[model samples]
Target chain A: MTIVSYIFLIIGAMFFLLGGLGVLRMPDTFNRIQAGTKATTLGAFSIVIGVIFGSVENHLDWIPKLIIIIVFIAISSPIGSSTIAKATYRSKNIPDNLVQDDFKKRGENQ
Target chain B: MKYLITFITLLVVYLFLAGFVIEEVILGSFVSAVLTILLANRLNFKVDWHFPLKLIKFIFVYIPVFIWKLILANIDVARRVLSFKIPLNPGIVKVKTNLKGDLGKLTLANSITLTPGTLSIDVEDDCIYVHTIDVKKSSKDQNQKEISGPFEKILGGIFE
Candidate 1:
């Protein structure tokens, strides 16, 4: 149990580090936010799953809580990231290298 | 009927989240009922009458695909980050989907967001704006084939 959890923990930490690197390396807020959200969602979820398996199971309580955390994160993360993207676009902080702009048509229609 | 279903669903979720504690369960049950009523319309609460058989298929099939994609997504992102050159050609490209149901579209959106290089920006009816980091020259065809097409293919069987 410890070994499996540790492996997952290491993988999660690696993903988290990658996400941090992505945020630093990406040129714009949009790219940074996307990288951060994607990596962190998976990263944190793996860590939670790892913990669910690793910890001493005196009672079977932690499993459900951890599962709920994963479900909650899965449902909410994309929505949150999309919300941030919407706000960033609305504020007109367009990235210098932004190539296409299809989202504006809907905004204009509104 | 919908309210009852919503209440029960929320109650179950509440219990799961609270981890079977007596005090938490009691308090959460009341809160769940209240919240269920408060957010009923937003929830679009409905149980498909054909749920059982479809759900069995979803569990057996779709889950494996989703899990596979989840693992691949993390690995892909990690690779992108570790690569020496900052490989980015980010753009919000318009892509169209034929998926009709809310659940199918939502699933596709979440899947796209979770997958590497593609982030779902907006879903307007049938059109989705996807922000991708790296764009291949044949990106138009590639994005359709790789990103939205696979999920949409499987989801059609489930949702449609």
Candidate 2:
């Protein structure tokens, strides 16, 4: 692999590590989701881009797949996070420091 | 005419992504688009193609800014995680959205959810229910309001 590709791979590995750390160390579910979603997306993207560069012969094919993967990640990650957050909130697993719950109020009103 | 346009757009997108032959892409897109249009019509859904062109510029500008904010939030969360004291006060707060349409609501929800330590729980009428992982005692209101900035700009660009 070229120097640039190695750099990208290293960066990607760092991001993935941070994401795992976030999941382990973050206090709450919401924070963990954020760490996992954002870091993994960028980390995976960087690694894939590196792979694309390393495989110059199949660059065209891999590049499109990478784009597709990025798009899919962008569209689905937030939705998945939102779903998990909502479930956690409803299940009362969130920490007690929260103030100003409009969702609960709306539920009460309804 | 709308159906034809939708069909063509879908076909082009399919061909571009799948790298299929023009003929196969055209056939597949036509079939899917026709089915989608019929289903949409039956569901009384309207497709608004008159998207504000001015908002396109805003979208392009907002993307980098949003990504920057995401990175900053990630760092903040990482720091909090590494700290000795677990300073967490998670709560759901409702912020009123100024966005006017379905697209605006979706954009706002997605943006909020993308940020670290926050999640968009629900959207009802003009308000978005967001859950924050860390809610400081004195600055709860300020934090909630600050969270709206990214969504406001991006949704405003897309909807307004």
Candidate 3:
């Protein structure tokens, strides 16, 4: 159990690192949101699961609290990313050389 | 009915967080009752004969699919970020959904954002504008089926 927990923790840390690197490397706001949100969401979930495993024997009650945390993250993270993406688009920080842009047409008409 | 639902949901959440202690459960029930009275009417949901079926499907089917897609999304992101060229042909394209319910549409948008290379930018009526990190240049356009993939069909069965 200890080994298993450690493995999950390590994996989570690696993903966190990747998310930071992605934020720095991506060209624009939307892409950075994509990398940052997805990677960190998974990373946090992994770390929580690790905590559950690590503490399960002595603290079974922690499981439900951890599950609640996971549920909250699953709900809130995407909403945050979506809001940022919308704000970025509305503020005209859109990237050049987009292959297709249907939003532009809709934005103009509306 | 709305009050009952809200009360029960809140109580359950409280109990889970409080570790089901005797005093905590009592306190939780009290708080939940007050909150339910105040907030019941604000939440919008429908309960019908299909409610149980939808709940089962959401738990058994939809969750697994979403998790699998999440893993794939991370791997895809990792590959792109790690690559030397960071190959990207990003774009925002519209995809249409037939779901009429607010919850259904919201779930669809969130699912798109968390899965694969797609992030939902905005939703307008029946359509969602998605930002894709790697747009297929061949088609020059995106369709609902390609962007949403398997989710729409399952979501339709559950939410609609």
Best by DockQ: 3
lDDT of 1 by residue, B60-93 (tens): 8777887788778777777777788767787777
lDDT of 2 by residue, B105-155 (tens): 886788787676677887888888887776655765687677787668666
Q: For model 3, how does the per-residue alpha-carbon lDDT over A86-108 read when each residue is reduced to its tens digit?
A: 98888876789787888989957
The collision pairs in model 2 are A97-B89, A98-B90, A98-B91
Q: Model 2, A85: alpha-carbon shift in Å?
A: 1.2
DockQ for the candidate 1 complex?
0.70
What candidate 1 gets wrong by more than 4 Å, as runs, is A104-110, B21-47
What TM-score describes the B chain of model 1?
0.77
Interface RMSD of 3: 0.9
What tens-digit string does per-residue lDDT give for candidate 1 at A1-110?
A: 78998998988887788889988987788888877987888789888878976874564668887777788898999899988887888898888786666676776766
Candidate 3: docking tier: high
State the lDDT at A62 in candidate 2. Answer: 57
CAPRI quality level assigned to candidate 2 from its DockQ score: medium
> In model 3, what is the error at residue B97, expressed in angstroms?
0.8
- Ordered by lDDT, highest first, the candidates read 3, 1, 2
For residues A69-103, write the lDDT of model 2, one tens digit per residue: 76687778788878887788789775654565667
Question: Could you tell me the fnat of model 2?
Answer: 0.71
